[model samples]
Target: MNLNFDFTEKRVIITAFFCMAFTIANLITVKVINIGFLGMETPAGVLIYPLVYILTNVIADVYGEKIAQRTIILGLCVDILFVFMTTLILFLPSPAYYTGDSSLAFVFTQTPRILVASYISYLIGNFVNARITAKVNEGKEYSSTKNLGILAFSELIDNFVFIGLAFVGVFAVTDILIMIVSHWILSLIWSAIAQPFTKMTVKWAEKGKPAEA
Candidate 1:
């Protein structure tokens, strides 16, 4: 596929990717991965989930906060639709020969508590990230580190709310807190490691075009 070089097309592409990532993350949250070195475990979805925030920040830098917020709202709607369709399919009757129904249900089923946690955390975390990133860039030029504080603060909120809601009473409070802190740190590390590349892309996209207010 040919890449679009136009700024407007780039913004659209990024927004599309943001929505896709959100949906994919939710779908994969059923799998857990062990972190041998840390003697900890986490959902496999955590690995790519951080990219959603990074892409949001990049969109905020390139297109502006209003666009970022709208894009996030769009993503939220897409996620809702995804959940609805998957749940419907999971409950639908399957043909006698269809042996994959169990696998589909296994991969797609999510408790109502988890669904709430996912939606709440996603909206709160992403909007805060976009708002802070935009506020920091007001009357100033974009920089890779400009929104570092936003990432840390908002990501912590994301993990805390998600864990507190989904796993509270299931895990000890101390263990829950540890999970939050560990996830937050890992997310920050992922974003920080991607900074240089993010900076380059933003710089290229912002050429001859000032970010919207």
Candidate 2:
């Protein structure tokens, strides 16, 4: 059976594709990625996750928080789909190339605790970032430096929630605190650097929105 999907006026599909790509790449990099910045070691994961946030922000800027919230829900749905599919595949018989289920376990066996944390934190933090950006724009603070405050605060929460979920107890408490701080700070830096580009992206989107009507 063939399903005729609507591509025109399909912002949800577009946003979901980008978010899925970001999530896949972010998952890969989270295992081992660190760099020293501002006398702190930061995870390279920030490079990818903030893009997701920026996309959400741009969605909110051009469309509205309602659409941005929809995108966040889309992300959560995709994550759940991944979890379910992986679990189903892991149970199936393996081919000869695979010695055992190690690879399956590696991919699908994230602790339930971590999975729950990741799901909750990601949905909350992402919506937080997008909502703040949307609110500021709606309030006509787009031209003010207060817009930067939106970025700073939201990115901090984004990084905090993500890193804390990804490695709250996996590392020592002290190391986890430092890592959380580093991830948060690095995300803030990326948000600032990317906000200008986001304005451009949002402007481009706005131009197209009226055309779609």
Best-fitting candidate, measured by lDDT? 1
Worst lDDT 10-window in candidate 1: 204-213
lDDT for each residue of candidate 2 in 1-213, tens digit (9 for 90 to 100): 654334334465459665785567436543555474455765455667777777777677667788788778877777777778877888899779888688657756666776676677777777786777777787352442555576667766755676677777688878877877777777777777877876766555554455443
Expressed as tens digits, the lDDT of each residue in 1-213 for candidate 1 is 875467777777788889999999898889987877577778888888988998888888678788999999999999999989988998888889889988888998899999899889998999999988888876677777666777888889899999999999899999998888878878898888888887887777776564432
Candidate 2 Cα outliers beyond 4 Å, as residue runs: 1-14, 36-44, 97-101, 139-148, 165-170, 211-213
The residue ranges of model 1 lying beyond 4 angstroms of the native Cα positions read 1-4, 208-213
Q: How big is the positional error of residue 199 in model 2, measured in Å on the Cα after superposition? A: 1.5
Which 10-residue span in candidate 2 carries the lowest summed lDDT?
1-10
lDDT of each: 0.85, 0.68
Q: Residue 101 of candidate 1: its Cα lDDT?
A: 89
lDDT of 2: 0.68
